[model samples]
Target: MAGLLQRVKSKMAIFAHRKARGMLDGEYGSVFKGRSLDFDDLRGYVPGDEVRDIDWKATARHGSPLIRRYAAVRRQTVLLVTDTGRNMAAEARSGEAKKDIAVLALGVLGYLAHRHGDLVGLVCGDSTATRSLPAKGGEAHLERLLGHVDSHTSLDAAASRIQEQLEYTARTIKGRHLLFVVADEIAADDAMAQLLRRLRAQHEILWLTVRDADLAPYPLTGQVPSAEVDYCSVADSALLPWQPAASAAVKAAYTRATAERDAARRAMLRAAGITEGEVAGSGDVITGLFALLERHRRAG
Candidate 1:
């Protein structure tokens, strides 16, 4: 079967290409607009009316003053860091795997960032950090970012590496923007915590993690190819031939490893004060963006 990245890349292109309309959430993307005035009800005031919105003629007739209220301005820059490590490909968590979910999540986030008029960029890597796209705005630029995320691959899965990447990201970004780190697992606790403390101090940071169901205890679809395989999940890389006789045991071990990684991720995020969104194999892009937007509002 084709990998999850390939599948989601084909699917999300359609959603991102569509022209956004009405509210941002309407297009299944996050919307960022400037300090546009929000209409609030008019109310009579005894003081602080600066002689504005006070129907002078009506006030003259009623002998009173009134004013209107508006919501605060909206201003933010966004930087997205995507971790495409081997941990994502582990068969432990969900049957669908983590890499697939992470890719789709990035596509959705890119769409929303474009809607809000915020510059969008991506940092994709594995054992060693790879591509770096500077945050920029425009339909074409976002398309390039989407294309970039489509090609990423990683070698490692430690969350501690996040701090190193974040520092580099901070140096390159040059501005306080909302930071989104999309990864499947968060096992490197101490590293993640330090990164979060510093990142949140300078910018609003959010972690978007896609979780699979299989790791939480589920039946396995037993099938082991009786042939040499490209094994990508081993800590110290080694290739081995698959044997159908032990497929069941292999599946069990896979399940346990994935479960441990998932638990580690949840615990690490909780300790770091980072929130998580579960991205399923068939998660909704629009729904997730709306929830994220609501969270941003609450924070504001």
Candidate 2:
């Protein structure tokens, strides 16, 4: 089988081709703050490049925009935080497994960290337990990290409880690091919100929410077709297709509840001072991450 890290690189390559060359790399690099003033080199400017980084004299001479690259004062650690449990094995909005989307997102960030000469670590677990891997460099180490996430998550695994991993990091991990989290739709809770706020105080954080599959078919005008609701819930045996008599009123309630949940989740993250981006599937990972990184840079 093709390696997971290889697949991530392939996706990044495609994104680079679709966008400007080195655009994603530039976006990833700029997300961090407080770099050394020591000049390293200059590269052609992309659309997302910071305006302040442009050297006007060099740009005028070269007849194109150029961005100054600085030697970073210190290497940063990017902690890939995620949930590895039955919840992740459930279907995502795009009908792909949520675990697959999580893995893809994690791999992309880890690859960007590796490219930037930053160490990458992982903190993931289900409700039963949490696991941590020390930050390290090199493609081999990244592969091992990705493989661990892939191998552990399954439909039979323990229920997902991202709070466990978050709490583990808070209690054990030391020093400042960039915490990149990817998880599915999570219900709002006061304790989780408070925990997130505390973590934000200690580290730079970015969150990516993998959209969950819809509970019911949209525009339910009654007499919904079986094909419309073919999927079954992973956490339960509830099957929408079996309930052909479900009225439009049912759909309305689901919509309202979903909207309220989303709003609350957003409010919680915003209150914690974290930047969030969402993806529905593997296809959206790169674009979502680009937006996430850009938002983090702007917020910082």
Candidate 3:
């Protein structure tokens, strides 16, 4: 028993160190406080059920003892929509990839939401969309979300699935929910808007641009250097096998084009009343997320 207790202690210490549990008991209003006890349902009053467990509503009707049951308070519903496209799977760290970053962020969010009595769900998209179980309160739900997230593969199959998922999301969910998207840079500035309108009609939306810095900045590496950078790949992928000078020019031109795309992306986000999240080189993913939630709460 002592050894078991020590193991438990060690596990808790490790979990606490991860900042997930730290934030749980942290000074913030994150720990979901209990709500006023209310009716849940009624069953037979057990020995420990306070006399108050008696449900007058059923008791009076049935002329028998019906213990009142009160379930835990309902928490917020926070949904994470992860892009499982090839873009999102790019490796940033030698060992950890962009998909790893996304999943880690989702884990953190799920843990925090669990503490706040919030229901957490995850939707991963490629060309198709894959979703975990619907949001419900509990650590089990978090585990389930992670399990589903881990099961996802970023191959081309997701393409068709994502479209179908988007179509399905519009039909099933009917009320406001907090929806977050973790995706690579978008091609269309208005892409997010269309997604929001179709897939997340009733939810408040936020988009987290998960990227590897290399995608934006091509570094001079190796004696031969990176394959001739073709600026037109994003615009037109047909131009290839250019001369070294052409590659240099392509790289320069891409620098400018990417900047323009970013500007357009942000402008579109603002127009749609959505918040943007950034996570870059050796970057701390939680920095912007904390601020996003705080600001959102204040707005609410």
- Which consecutive 10 residues in model 3 have the weakest lDDT in total? 27-36
Off by over 4 Å in 3: 1-73, 92-95, 155-167, 189-192, 197-201, 212-247, 281-283, 298-300
- As a whole number from 0 to 100, the lDDT of residue 195 in candidate 1 is 65
Please report, in order, the local distance difference test score of every candidate based on alpha carbons.
0.57, 0.86, 0.56
Best by TM-score: 2
- The Cα error of candidate 1 at residue 259, in Å, is 5.0
Q: Model 1: what TM-score?
A: 0.61
Q: What is candidate 3's TM-score against the reference?
A: 0.63
Per-candidate total of colliding backbone pairs: 9, 0, 10
Task: Report the C-alpha lDDT of model 3 over 7-33, residue by residue, as the tens digit.
Answer: 323443565677744553342243224
Where is model 1 more than 4 Å wrong at Cα? 1-75, 85-100, 154-161, 212-219, 222-234, 239-264, 282-300
Whichever of 1 and 2 has more lDDT, that candidate is 2
- Candidate with best lDDT: 2
CA lDDT, candidate 1, residue 267? 76
Which candidate, 1 or 3, would have the higher TM-score against the true structure? 3
